[model samples]
Target: MTEVKKQKPGNSVLGLFKEIFNWYPSSYPAAERKLLFKLDLSILIFACLCFFVKFLDQTNISNAYVSGLKEDFALNGNELNYFNVCYYVAYVIFQVPGMLLMSRPQLSRWLLPTLEVLWGICTFAQSRVTNVHQLYALRFLVGMLEAPVFAGTHFILGSWYSGPELFKRAGTWFICNPLGSMISGYLQSAAYTNLSGVGGMEGWRWLFIIDGIFTLPVALLGFIVFPGVPDSPKPFYFTSDDIALARARLARAKIRKPGPLNLDVFKRSLARWHIWIFVLCYICMIIGGYPTSYMNLWLKAEGFSVVQINQLPTVTYAINILASWLGTTLATIYPSWTIYTGATGGMVFSGICMIVWNIPKALKFVAWYVFGVSGCLSPILYSTVNTVVKGDSEERALIMGSMMTFGYSFNIWVPLLLFPTAGPNGAPRWRIGWPVAMTFHILLWAGFITSLLLHRRE
Candidate 1:
């Protein structure tokens, strides 16, 4: 007869607290806690900073658009939309290749930092663009460099943390997106006030310059301190025993060290339900989530000052962080419930808000709020993908890359095709786009249900 292990009662207050935070699993030894503290301090800190800066760099373009880039470069008539799409096209093209290279053990140490530095340089060069073509070229380069970092970092986090630990950690890491936006808004406000006309650069140009200059030092630090995966030599903070424990824990969890890219892994991953279902879920999530750039665009058209436009979006980001924290915390406790609740609930609320947006100015702001908050689905979706493919390193990498690749691939054209920026005579504000996005959100909800059913069946 098979032995049935008894489940522990998680009723103790201390136990409940730890479980809620995903801190210090009760089974951990004192030494394990010490090691984890070190890992969290060194690895998580750098990873979060890298992601924070990357997003800040990415979103600064939107800020620049409002500040002065559009006027300075003579941008009119779909050029801004095209510029946005160019980044994603490069992203779709380069993400998988970048991940392939980053997964190599020999290149793992240097690839991320090198890419960060290069992208930072590319971002800085944006300040100097004289025309739309120069802006497009630079955005593509920036996108290419940024392609692998998000998914690559997520994969690394998965490699280090166990299944239960992964969601909250990913939440904390992903929260940096909102945090970055908040910080960038403030930074842009400061730059526009203080740096305008300095060195003949517009405040928006100064924003790019300052953002780029800040990135290189971080790249240097990441190269020095960020721990690679367990398969590599132990980081200086980790003892040999800590390394052994790390490997053993992952081994017991069936996590595999990544191997070189090959046909067999691709064939096998394509055959798996988890990869396809979750990746499809991801594509829907991207389509259904709030449009970041549109919020600023709307505010700009509503006759808000540049600073008001910059600052208002931070409120959206604030609400986003709360929703994200709530969703991830609930997911840590109940994965299925959080998954269903976030996808279905957020979509319904956002769809209604978008549909009824014109009733009041307050309603429009509320629609944007709900849309931003709905971004909680992003990390939940990513964590689901990470957990589903945890044990196979190559498959995990391929799936992660493919998930982003296809998601961005859709982004390259779908928004352009479906969400027209203007009607005849250059009228602004795509109110029609909101309902279109809401319609897609309904489709996304269906996709989530199908994915859940598929996952449950497996």
Candidate 2:
């Protein structure tokens, strides 16, 4: 008899580690593993960088306001809220159109980077605003450009990755939001400390300039690295065989290729409960998490130094990053419903703590830190949407867009009313904001339950 060698067990310790951490299952062929590695290196890196810079640019306004924009503009009223409203309005207007445009592979690669460049220009322009009106105009433009980045990137990721591979990747990309915010905190602190008066500009102005500068290189890299949805033009880095493998994998997972976008696609998407339910759920999740945005303001009002105000909130972002990583890892291993349940419970607990509002300072800090659990929910929810709508590419794109559009549409008026900076209810414990946020968190839990029931029925 010929000598035979025994193969190692597939469930070896190293294989388990690979599946847990690398998203690489031992069951995959060597070729498939290689393909995933390449996709991760190129597509995931670009997506993470793009999202990271987007948040950096977006959150810088808050940092700038705290650093000096508030004083320099004499914004004692609700000008900051108005700035956000301008952005939100523009964001809502462009959100669906941008996602629809991104569905066409020909446009996505160019559209993403071009929009990035435009927004970078607009972000840089914010550095020179003489009045709030000018800043408002730039904010609108930046919002319009940035609206597509989140939903569109998710759409692209959903197109390329299967369900088993998606959550961890999505979670990794989603964490960049807090990572960007975390870095922005440190950056603003540094800018204020070192560059406050350089060239007769306020430190806040330098913050925008640096943020704008940071955006351009990443945008340029997108052109080189962004592989459009696998159906789009083949990327330079991917061999034809690689492209074939990608399409094959998605097909094997039963993910449909892009369908033509027309009235029926819209009709079908709108008629389905998926869009509405997900939209409502997303809106509640976002509104419920809104209180964390006021952390810096609260710290400032509590008589903290500017450095402390800027640096302290970073702890929340750090918690957010950790929560996202752990939550997504567990999600990959556990039942999908459990992820939402845990997130909803954590957020509800935080919401209750905020509504109580008279807790010890340390307990208050704990509430804010616990609130970071909200960071993980977005990836889980969006990944669920991707998996649920995998059969219809157009519907997936539309639902993603609608989720973002309707979710943000609330911000246009909600912040003005609940989280206002003027009138009787202002920042630093806007008495109404926490209570309202708590109510929304409760609603989010209901939505989670409804979603679970619906999924089971289907």
On lDDT, the leading prediction is 2
For 206-323, candidate 1 gives per-residue lDDT tens digits of 8888888878988998888777778775567678898898888788777788876789988898888867776776787677663644677878889999999899888888887776
- The pairs that clash in candidate 2 are none
RMSD of each: 3.3, 5.0
| lDDT against the true structure, each candidate | 0.75, 0.84
User: Best candidate per TM-score, number?
Assistant: 2
Candidate 1 Cα RMSD (Å) = 3.3
Clashing pairs for model 1 are none
lDDT of 1 at 31: 82
TM-score against native, each model? 0.92, 0.95
